[model samples]
Target chain A: MRVLIPIDGSECSKAAVDYIKERPWNKDDSFLLVHVVEPIPVDIGIAYIPAAYTPDEGAAFTQSEALLQVVLGDLKSVLTNQIDTKVIAGPAKAEIVDLAQEWKADLIVMGSHGRKGFNRLLLGSVTEDVMKSAPCSVTIVKSAHCSKSE
Target chain B: MLLNLLSAPKTNLRSLTNMKILISLDSSSSSQRAIDFALSRPWAEDDEFLIVSVVDVDRGDMSMASAMTSPNKTFNSEAERIVSEAKELLHNYLPQHKLETRCLSGPIKQAIIECAKNWSADLILLGSQGRQGLNRLVLGSIAEEVLRDAPCSVQIVRRKFSRREDQS
Candidate 1:
């Protein structure tokens, strides 16, 4: 089984990681951790954008990369298996759903606050979009503890 | 057929509370897929399963409710049969565990959420019809609503497509 998990380093995102820790696993099953970095507006340095990279965009990419490493490190300590990690930049909902399909993930596990930007936005919940569009099963972990109810 | 641990790796056996699971059921094939998926999972020994089927009924008129009550009573009987059959099917699979079945009358999403909340369910399993794009938005979905306001976690299970369906 191939599982895809999207995280954003929020409390709920860590909770999702915790939730996965409590579940059972199989030997051949692998994990793909995805972190989507929302694109920063290019307006900050548009005059210099046409040449090299803008400062704002460069800063944003660096931040997202650091977060991905932190999350992967935390997961590596808890899990003893083959785990793959990827960091992409795009709209949170579209990127997550697209990656799950492209990777042929058997399941997509997302946390309550895993979406980028504000949790609930005008475009609809990012988690909800992934749930609706992903090519496989989707499990939304609200509370870190599976036994706990909201 | 049996491997080691898949993705969700850990098995925290310390918290030994009986897991309350609410599975939203219907007469659709997708719902059966959800049940099959749940049954195939390696649940804890103390896990308790609750199968609930909701009969969507308008609040305006209880006596003339669409699915809950009909002049010929077809919908009411079918709803009861579905839930009862599900209970029996599940019993055959996991007879040692505790199980309960209920037929609720109300809006599909509201009824399922209410049952899950009252039961203090640890998890909810729902079947997605796999409707796409405009259709989903126009008709909405019970699974969507329950996911937003559920008392606990929710899993949306989809039916596995057959080889013949894949070609199309």
Candidate 2:
């Protein structure tokens, strides 16, 4: 089986990785870790003249690559299966579902919430969107904090 | 650093035995596929399963009134049949493991979650109706709502891509 996991360097995402590490998976199953870097939105204002400032694409990719490497090392310690990593820049909701469909993933494992700052307000639009359009099975792993509260 | 972060405090070793799994099933084909997917996975020898189907008394006005009035005759038999069918399917494959069937009457989502919490299930496996477009917008998904509030990890099973492609 092919499993796709989307991470965002959040505490909940780490819980998802831990869940995958503890689960009993087949020896031949493969896992792919995908991290999507949402592009910084450009300000569109009609009244004020803004300075010419472009978002640094290079820095964003570098950070995403480092995160993936760290996650890969952690997963490798527990799993002996074929593990792969990919860093993409796009809307997380669309990229995750598209990647799962393109890769023909059997299952998608992810955290209930992502690394957005205002977590209390925007609970998890990315997860909600992925769950809506995923072409395969989806597993939503809640963090220890969330589960304990219930 | 990453390894340390990933190491959440686990109370007990999550071994492949004695896992309590709660499977929520309804009369939909999506739920039937969920059972098939559950049986396909590798489970521990001593794992226990609770196959449940909620009567959804609040869904229909007539059923709600009947549930309050007659109680026994209020779509309870349908829920019993749903759970029994799932139990029979699993029993053929896993005869040694403990299998229990239950019929619940209440709101569908709340009943499933309440049962899972009381049972202290390790995992909740259910099927998504796979609703899309305007229908999806109008009617909310129970699987998604369960995933949000479930005490344990929730797995929303779906048909394979190959099978879906063949059908389309």
Candidate 3:
């Protein structure tokens, strides 16, 4: 089976990695670990603070790339040999679905905050969007256990 | 509303040997994938499988209401049609496994959650459309809501299939 796991550098996302590690997967199964970097809102950058320290368009692009590399490095450390990693830039839910379709992954395993009521309504979960739109099977690992430590 | 029921303390695991599993059905490839995944697992011998198809009354009013309320020979005929199709599909895939089928009326997500709680299902499995972009943002996904509030563990299946690439 081909599985796609999306990580956001959150411990909840890492829980998915741990779940797979504990499972008894066949040698034939392959995994793709994906991380999506949402495009930085240009307005936020322009609106904030010191004009001297503010980066130009080219400099901002470079900074985003650097940030992506750092996040990918963290992902690489936890991912086992069984998993392959891909880092892309876009909205988390859309990019994840696109990658799943491109790879023809049989399953998508990711983490959920398990938000409820007003919080869920306001936050609008990415896990929810992925569940609605994924072309393959999806497994959502709720991070209730992670919240306890916080 | 169903969240209250789900939040109730979990039943003893030791007494759950014969638990039921509700597999939500649609014509999507992802739904079929979920069925395949469930069958692949080693479930207890006494466990039951209930395949359910919910008719979303809110989506279409007259047609759905007529199908459910008509007492004549044509009563719930559309629902029956869907139930039959689901049964055929399930039987074709799981011929040996004993299965039960039901067609209920309500919102899809709410109906599925209620059925899971009513049946005390140990797990709920669903196949997602995997719709993305602006379309998905406007219309929320059922699989996501079920995952968050389901009384039991929920599995969302997407249709992506990957083959192992040999490293050697």
Best of the candidates, lDDT: 2
Provide the lowest-lDDT 10-residue window in model 1 chain A.
A46-55
Model 3 regions more than 4 Å off: A9-11, A18-27, A36-81, A87-91, A114-124, A132-135, A143-150, B1-20, B26-48, B55-100, B120-122, B129-168
The better-scoring model by TM-score among 1 and 2 is 2
* Model 2 per-residue lDDT tens digits across residues B30-103: 78778987666667677899999887655544436657787656577777888898898898878888999888
For candidate 1, write residues B1-168 as lDDT tens digits.
Answer: 011112334433334245688988877777777787766665667889998887764432344455344533655576788878888878888889899988887777888889988988878988776222126563237677788888677888865633233222
**For residues A8-121, could you state the per-residue lDDT of candidate 3 as single tens digits?**
545456545544554445555677777665654465564533332233334433443454354345444654445576666667779988998999877788766432333543
Flag the better candidate by DockQ, 2 or 3: 2
Instruction: Report per-candidate DockQ.
Output: 0.23, 0.33, 0.17
Best by DockQ: 2
Chain A vs. native, model 2, TM-score: 0.85
Runs of candidate 2 with Cα error greater than 4 angstroms are A41-57, A121-123, A146-150, B1-4, B7-18, B59-74, B130-134, B138-140, B160-168
> What is the Cα-based lDDT of residue A114 in candidate 3?
32
Residues forming the 10-long window of minimal summed lDDT in candidate 1 chain B: B1-10
Superior by DockQ: candidate 1 or candidate 3? 1
Judging by DockQ, tell me the better candidate of 1 and 2: 2
Tens-place lDDT per residue, model 2, A59-104, is 6666677788888988999999889999887788999999999998
